[model samples]
Target: MATAAIARPQVSDAEWEARQELAACYRVFAMLGWDEMIYNHITVKVPGEDNAFLINPYGLHFSEVCASNLVKIDIDGNKLTDNPYPVNPAGFTQHSVFHRHLPDAHCVMHTHTTAGMAVSALEGGLQPINFYACNFIGQVAYHDFEGVTVRAEEGERLIANLGDKRAMFLRNHGILVMGKTLPQAFLMHWGLQRACEIQMATLSMGQPVHVPEDVVAVHQRDLSKVQIPGGPGKADFDAMVRLVDRIDTSWRN
Candidate 1:
């Protein structure tokens, strides 16, 4: 099916740049196979705007998203842009909670990958059996699955469980990660998804996976030290954007 052309809403330079970065994020997710059709969403706050943000349009695949096509909406789910696609109500319900509560979280990503959902269903979520898993040892939060997150009231509970953590495991549902920038959020989700994958693989071996608590602690500390602004994540995100362009630059449209 042919995707609709964006109406190109009037936005400032900063907001346009944000749209491009967020559109690139959607493409990267699609490239990594993390996108669950058109279900999951990655939302970023519109630069310089308090209550406005950008989100994937409903019914379009992640690969089909572009800077101009992303829908702009307010905290109350009102569309500020003339978009042909509707916003996902559940997505708004979950993301608005974070954007409103966590003032520092500029980028919020949600995914329903196989490994992520698998770990979410496990009684022991995100085991620290591997280096990737260890990075989130003391940084992960958990929210119990409460059916679909379409209710406006559920946002408060979600916020409460998330606290100030950067990553969260949505019990029996999926994963949520937030960051001060798109790069940080993307890297966080990458690490978390990999950790979940490693955990599942280690469990299938049915053998004791041993990583000393001291070692895990060291790794966690190292990871924390690298969480500086415009750090490695920014460079890596730039590289990924180049890679996506090499494959197909249509996502930049």
Candidate 2:
């Protein structure tokens, strides 16, 4: 079936640019196999709008998402635009909590990747076994799964668990990553997924060699200061955007 072309939303230049970057994030999610059909969400705050943000339309695959097709909604899950597609209630409930409580969280992404889910189910969330894992030491939180996230109180619990952290493990479910910018969120997810993948692979063999706690602490501190273009998330995302454009440029619409 041929998909209809997306008409760009009438928004400010900043918002339009945010939509494009978010759309690019979705396309990259598809490219990296981070998308779990239509079950998860990657959302970015709309510039200049308090309690407003952009999220993927409910039925669209990550690959099918485009800037114009993205839906704008308030923290309460009310649609702020005249979009035909419905928003995912679970997505809103989980993401809105961070968007509303954390002033610095401009982007929030949730994923149900295999490795992430496996790690989430483990007794320990993410371990500092490698460089990627080391980056998350003392920086990850855990939330006990309470079925689907659709109730208001769940948001409260989620925020309490997340408290100032950039990443979280939704036990028996998946992972969530947040950032002050879209690029930071994407990079955080990438590093987290890699860490989970490595952890699972090593566990399959036997107990993995753990980096010394002091050395891990040092690595975390040093890594936190390592910023590249676009705030530690730019270089790789730019490369991935070009790659996805080569495959299909419709996401830019």
Candidate 3:
């Protein structure tokens, strides 16, 4: 698929902004070594259209995704724009279901990072032993894996298992996170990933100390609706986007 910049006015400013942010997200994941080749997906619903979303071209690496080349598709995976690139079947199947069912799921991210996969494979799942783990003590949900997630039936189960939770682990597979905003989702995954990495490291050595539930409850209560000191907010996302531009502003295309 060509990465050539899409001509302007073909899309609304809101849609274009969504493209740039989604593209920047891909690059940020690439920089963090969280991408699984060209397999995993980060999807964002187009701001101006209902049930319409954008995904990376199936054959393109995260680094290769640009605002213009990102494929625009509807909830049913039908291409809404003319493009040489195709959308990944698995990505579409899962992402569409989430978008259709959850209003807050404006941005859905699925990844197969080593730590994310490792945590998913573990029977214990993500434990509340690390600072990052505290953000999702009782917040994480789990789903039983049903082969590759290309089938629509599997999507129903995925959403059912997801319930109202923002983060989910596809047991024996990987991590899935949703957010009302990209910053929230990205921060959730970052915290989850760091938790898993720390858990794996500490478990290899011996029994790890767990954070108290009372403390987590308190934090969860206090953390809602307010931007804590180190919390991932819009500011953090803006900083990361700047970093992506420094590396390569092609994402802005």
* Candidate 1 structure, TM-score to reference: 0.95
Worst 10 residues of 1 by lDDT: 223-232
RMSD of 1: 1.6
| Model 3 CA deviation exceeding 4 Å by range | 1-9, 224-232
Measured with C-alpha atoms, the lDDT of residue 222 in candidate 1 is 75
Off by over 4 Å in 2: 1-5, 224-226
* Per-model CA lDDT versus the true structure: 0.89, 0.90, 0.87
Worst 10 contiguous positions by lDDT, candidate 3: 1-10
Best by lDDT: 2
Q: Write the residue-wise lDDT of candidate 2 on 1-253 in tens digits.
A: 3445557878999999999999999999999999887779999999999789999998889999999999999988998887888888999888998889898899999999999999999997888897899988898999999999989898888988888788999999999999988888888999999999999999999978989999988887787566765567888789899999999998888
Better of 1 and 3 by TM-score: 1
Candidate 3 vs. true structure, TM-score: 0.94
Error of 3 at 245 (Å): 1.4
lDDT of 3 by residue, 1-253 (tens): 4455555428888898998889899999998898888799999989967789999889888988888889999998899888887788999999999998898899999999888899899987988888778889899999988899899988878888888798999998999999988887888888888888998898999998988999988878877666755545577777888888898998888
lDDT, model 2, position 228: 64
